[model samples]
Target chain A: MIEIRNLTKRFGSLTAVDDVSFDVGRGEVLGFLGPNGAGKSTTMKMVTGFLAPDGGTIRIGGLDVASDPVEVKRWIGYLPEGAPLYGEMTVRAFLRFIAEIRGLRGAEARRRIDSAIEQVSLGTVLEMPIDTLSKGFKRRVGLAQAILHDPHILILDEPTDGLDPNQKHEVRTLIRGMSAEKVIVLSTHILEEVDAVCTRATIIANGRIVSDGTPEELLRRSRMHNALRLGLVVGDAGSAGVVETLKAVPGVALVEVDAQSGNALEVMLFPAGGVPLAGPAGEAARANGWEVTELHVERGRLDDVFRAITVGEGGASHG
Target chain B: MANVWIIYKRELSAYFGTPIAYVFLAIFVFLSGIFAFYIGNFFEREQADLQAFFQFHPWLYLFLIPALSMRLWAEERRAGTIELLFTLPVTMTEVVLGKFLAAWKFTAIALSLTFPFWITVNYLGDPDNGVILAGYLGSLLMAGAFLAIGSCISALTRNQVIAFVVSGVVCLGFVLSGFPLVLDFVGAVAPPIVVDTVRSFSFLTHFQAISKGVLDAGDVIYFVSLIVFWLFVNAVVIEWRKAG
Candidate 1:
């Protein structure tokens, strides 16, 4: 378990992390979400004992971080942002160095090294220098070292930041596989990763956490939650009637007409009082004998919610 | 102790893992030989003693030792590996001592490689072997002192070039403190006691005494304490500025 309270950090006049606090218990994978400079990496640095919090208390397991940093570090494995490594060393030598520093020796060291290598599937690049590897392999090597000691807490910063889609899936699977026993905290701007791996997601913006909850709960905060997208093979003139009829449906509070593409009209129907509108809206459309082409319920988009909560509208970001 | 040994092994191997160790060793041997044989006129002096070789070590180390120590912490910071290291379970003391020892041992290897001078002197004349051994010890101690200063300076910055240049300037000040140029300037304004104090801190004062076969306790203590003091500062600097 990792406990942080009132954690704050400042770089000169700017407050990087302002009174941030959170906890991650065993078997919980917490996905840290934020914009480019939203203190995700700073918070991870403090938790891993790499940077001291200006005003806060951090506890790992039961020990205080400030008072017992070395002991706390022994229980935590951190992969810093950019996955900085000794570029000159071969993959095997680098892993061996980390194992020894973690106090593993002889056969125990070899066993852990072997397992970590196998877990990351780095057998082929054992003799290859880290600097010579591709960005994907370098990231895997960083992951391998972090998991070599099998620490109880894993703090990874943007673990899959620059990887191909397939590599991203493999890394997510690896993180999910380890989520059953360890308290994992990884930061990324990728919204799908929150749904793919995280048990809980925290969104931070402007050095403060704007929202924190499970992926499903966060989606509910979206403006389009439980809404319906109705596609019709109708002209712009016909879309007016479609909008009027959709607004008159029982649960739909409002209907928005979107731009026409080809000969089809797109309209979004919002629910009233958190009620489900898909069943009623579909039945209403069927009774009218409308040229209905497409209709589906919106589970709420993380991208929309992320934009709404961070920097507001008209502000473009990675999400 | 175990952690120190582990870090030491890695740091030492790291030196050999790149062209750094070989290049440093080659340049160090080649430069020292050129200085002793050509400049010091070892053949012209007709002296079997390695006095000609050992005298130039303090000057040779001024540039070479800083080059070796410049990367001690500066490179770690530039590559962002310092974050990885500090996040590990090792204490700052273990890391400082380990890196210092590794550089010291590497310097020792370079110094011992000049044993052909010892062999040539022994084969040529009846030079006092004991004095030559003392010179070697003093030279090694002086090199350690220089390296410790460089290490501390390296921790203060992320730029290796700045570390190297600043360390070279600082080490030069220490090496020149006992010379007439420094003493004359100090003696003109300061009292004899102040002048003596300044000379006492000079590397030359203690090193020259030990090089002349006089293993005074004070000189040995000076070098050892200098190493310890600088290393302590190195650790403190790392702790204070690592987060920045």
Candidate 2:
């Protein structure tokens, strides 16, 4: 388990991370979502003991990151934003070096190195110098080094930034596979990735976490009102009264004509449950002698919730 | 100590894994050979000691040692690998000592390659083997002192070029402080005691004393203290940077 309390980082006048606190339970996969300069990377650096925080404390498995950094480091594996590596060393050699530093020796060290290489699928490039590998391969090599010690906590910053679709799937699968035994925290700007992998997410904006919850829960909470959009073809001029009648329905909060064309009216329906009153909306429209051209329920997605929480705007759809 | 050895082995392998070590060794041996045979007139002078060969080492190391040691920490910082190293379980002291020892050992290998000259001197003239051994020991100690200074300078910057130039200039000051021209210039302005004190702190003065077949405790202490002082400075710099 990882517990962060009142964590803050200041660089001169800019607070990179501002009093952010969160708990990551064992066997949990948490996604850190943020836009550019949102302090996700800064928080990860502080947790991994690479950057010192100006305030608060980060505890990994009950070990204080500041007071017992070595012990905390021994329990965690970190991959920084750019996947820094020694370009001169071969893939196998670099993994061996990391293993040696992690206090692995003899047959055990070799076993770990081999297992990491296999896990990251780096066997084909094992003999190549790191500088000669492609960006995706380099990322895999970095991942291999991070997990060489079988650490209990994994902190990865943008782990799939450079990977192709297939490699991304492989890495996600690997992460999900390991999530059952360790606490995995990854930060990315990809919303689909969060929906695909994260059990819960903490959305950060301007150096502070604005929202934190499970993916489904975040979407549900951020859905302030149920609304549906419908496009209708009116046989005559009677459709105008249908909008007023739909507004009089039990759960209907508001109704507005979205657009108009020749013999067609597109209307937006707002309901109190934030669940679309489309069922009642369709019946009311038919009763008023209007032909329903398009009727569908609108469910808020994770992207809508992310934009609403981070940008303070709810109308923007990521699709 | 085990951690130190772990770091040491990795560092040593890193040196050999690249072309840098081989190129440095080739240049070092080539220069030493030229100085010993051609410049020192090994066969013609028929010296009973390795004084002529050992005399040029301090000057040679002034440039060579910095080139070898300047990349110790500067490259690590520039490449962002310093983050990987610091987050490991090892302490700062072990990292410094391990890198220093690896560079020192590489210098030793280069110095030992001149054993053919030792054989040549023995075959041509009966030189004192004890003096020859002491000369090699003194040379290694001098190289360690130079490397320590370079290591500290390397820790200050991420640009290896700047680290090399700055360490080279600082080392040049130590080499020239004991010269008569520098001492004479100092004598014209300061008290004689002050001038002597400045000269006493020079590496050349102590290195010269030991290379002359005399194992003086003061000179030994000077070299040892020089290495320790600079290494301690390196540790302090790292700590300050980490805190900041």
Candidate 3:
């Protein structure tokens, strides 16, 4: 378990992390969602004991971080933002060095090194210098070092930042596989990543956390949650009439034309409060003799919730 | 201590993993020979001692040791590996001591390569082997002092060129502080005691005494304490940089 309270860090006059606090227990994967410079990396640095916080305290497994930093560090594995490694060392030599300092020795060291190599599929490039590897392999090498000791906590910063889609899937599967026992915390701007891997998502903006909950809870906060998209066989000249008719549905509070083509139209009907509008809207459409081509309720769009919460903050969406 | 040893092995191997170790060793041995034989006229002097070879070490180390120690921490910062290192389960003192000791040992290897000079003098004449041994010790201690200064400066910036140039200038200041040209200028503005205090801090004053076969406790203490002081500062500088 990792617990942080009232953490703060300041660079000159700018507050990089401002009284931030959160906790993660065993078997929980917390995804830090934010824009660039939203203090996610800063918070991770403080938790890993790389940077000291100006105020507040961090406790890992019941030991204070500032007082017993090395002990705390022994229980955690960290992959820094860029996954920096010694470029001159061969992959095998580099892993050996890390294993040695992590207090593994003899057969135990060899065993851990072999396991890490196998886990990351690094057997082929063991003799190659890290500087000569591609970006994907370099990242895997970084991951291999972090897991060599099998620490109880894993703090990975943007673990799949530059990976290809297949590699991303592999890494996500790896994280999910490891999430059953370790307290995993990873930060990313990718919304789909949170849904795929994280058990909980925390949205942060401007050095402050805006929301923290499960992916489903945050998705339900979207305005489009439970809203229905109705595709009607109405002519282009009747889009205005279609909107007026759907606006009179019992649970729908708003109706707008989403798309228009000759003799076909797509419109959205937003529910009032938390009610589901599909049943009432469907009955109204049948009574009006309208031909309904397509209709489905949205589970909610995370991107919309993410944008709504972090829009005015700096660099909200580069997409 | 175990942690220090682990770091030390990695750092020492890091030197050999590149062509740096071989290149540095070759240049160091070659340069010492050129300086001692051609410039110091070792053959022309026909001396029974290695005074000519021992004298140029301080000057040679002024440039060479800076080149050696410039990458100690600067390269780690530039490559962003310092974060990886600091986040590991090791203390600051262990890392600093480990890196310094590795560089010092590499210098020791280069110094030991010059044993042929000792062999040549022994084969040619009845040179006092005790004085030559003392010279080697003095040279090693002086090199340690220079390395400590360079290592501390290396921790101050990410640019190795800046670390090299600044360390060279600082070590030059230490070597020249005892000369009359500098003391005379100091004497013009300060009291005699102040000039004497300034003169006592020069690398020349301490190293010259030991090079002449006088293993004074004060000189040995000076070099050891200088190394200790600078390494402590190196740790402090790293912490400050991390915070900044």
Candidate 4:
């Protein structure tokens, strides 16, 4: 388990991470979602004991990061942003070095290194120099190094940033498999990636966490209005009255009459509470002498929720 | 200590894994040979001491030692591998000491290869082999001192080029502090006590005392303390940057 309390970092006059606090339980995959310049990487660095927090505490497995940094580091396996690696060393050599530093020795170290290589599917490039590999393969090499010691917490920054589609699938599967024993925290801006891999997400903006919850819960909390659009075939001069009558329904919020083509009119309905209005709107249209030809309910997508919670509407505050 | 040794093995192997070790060794051997044969007049006067060889080491190290130590931490920071190293279970002391030892040992390897020159001196004349051995020890100690300074300077910057330049200037100041040119210049402007204090801190002054076939306890203590002091500074710098 990891507990971060009021973690803050300041670089000169710039407050990069501002009094952010959260907890990550064991076996939970938490996605850190943010745009460019967010404090995701800085927060990871502090938790991994690479950077000291200016004004808070981070404990990994009950070891304080600042006071017991060595012990905390022993519990963390971090893959830094961009996967910084020693290009001069071969993949095997680099893994062995990391293993030695993590206190693995003899047969145990070798076994762990071999398994990590297999896990990252880097067995083929084990003997090759890391500088000679492509970007995707180099990332795999870095992943192998991070998992070589098999710590309880894994902090990966952009694990799938440079991977191809098939590679991304394999890495996602690997992460999901590892989530049974590891507290995995990964960062990405990809919405679908969070939906596919993360059980929970913390969205950060302007150096503060704006929202935190499961994917479905975030969608429910954003609570933007849902809409339905319908094309109708009605008698002449009756389409205006049909739109006005549909607007009077209990769940319907607004009704707009669209352009007419011959005898057909397009009518759009907005629901106040994001309810499924297609069926009710169709019924209301049918009762008003309008033959409903097309009706579709549009639910707010995760992208819409993200934008609403992060940017919000004009003059809207997100806290 | 075990963690220090682990880092030591990896860093030492890295030196050998590239052409750096070979190049440094070749240059050191060629320079030592030239100093022994031409400057010392090994065959003409048949000197019984290694003064000529040891005399030029401080000047030689003023350039070469910085080159060897410049990349020790600067490259790690530039390549972002310092994050990997800092996050490991090893402490800052271990990392600094391990890297210092690795660079010192590389210098030791180059010093050891000049043993063939020692053999030639022994073959040509009734040289004081004990004094020659002491000179080699003094050279190694002085190299460690230079390397410690270089390592500390290297930790201050991420650009290897800047590390090289800064470490070079710092090492040069130490090497030139005791020379007549610098001491006379300082004497003309400063008080006697100030000049004496600076002269006492010069690495070349202590190295020269040991290189003259006399192992002064004060010089030995000075070199050892110099190594420890600079390594402590290295640890502090790394810790400070980590906090930043």
| Tens-digit per-residue lDDT, A1-319, candidate 1 | 8988999999898788999888899999999998898899999999999888899899999999999999999999999999999998999999999999999999999999999999888999999999999999999999999999999999999999898999999999999999999999999989999989999999998678888899999999888898888877754446678788888899889999876776677789999878898778778777776567888888899998898888762154334
Docking class of 3: high
- Chain A only TM-scores, each candidate in turn: 0.94, 0.83, 0.93, 0.83
**DockQ winner:** 1
lDDT of 4 at A98: 90
**Which candidate comes out best when scored by TM-score?**
1
Of the two candidates 1 and 4, the one with more favorable DockQ, higher being better, is 1
Model 2 quality (TM-score): 0.89
Q: After superposition, how far is residue B128 of candidate 1 from its true place, in Å?
A: 1.7
User: Candidate 3 regions off by >4 Å?
Assistant: A235-237, A279-293, A312-319
Candidate 4 chain A weakest lDDT stretch, 10 residues: A310-319
lDDT of candidate 4 over B1-244, digit per residue (tens): 8999989988998888788789989998998788767887766765766777788899889889999999999988888988988888889889998989989999999999988878777777788888888899999999999999999999988888999999999999998899889999999999999899889989889998899878999999999999999999998898888533
Q: Which wins on lDDT, candidate 2 or candidate 3? A: 3
Clashing pairs in 2: A225-A274, A226-A274, A226-A275
**Candidate 2 RMSD to the real structure:** 4.0
lDDT of model 4, residue B134: 86
Query: Model 4 chain B, poorest ten-residue lDDT window?
Result: B40-49
Q: RMSD of each candidate? A: 2.4, 4.0, 2.4, 3.5
CA lDDT, candidate 1, residue B199: 98
TM-score of chain B of each: 0.98, 0.96, 0.97, 0.96
Return the candidate ranking by TM-score, descending: 1, 3, 4, 2
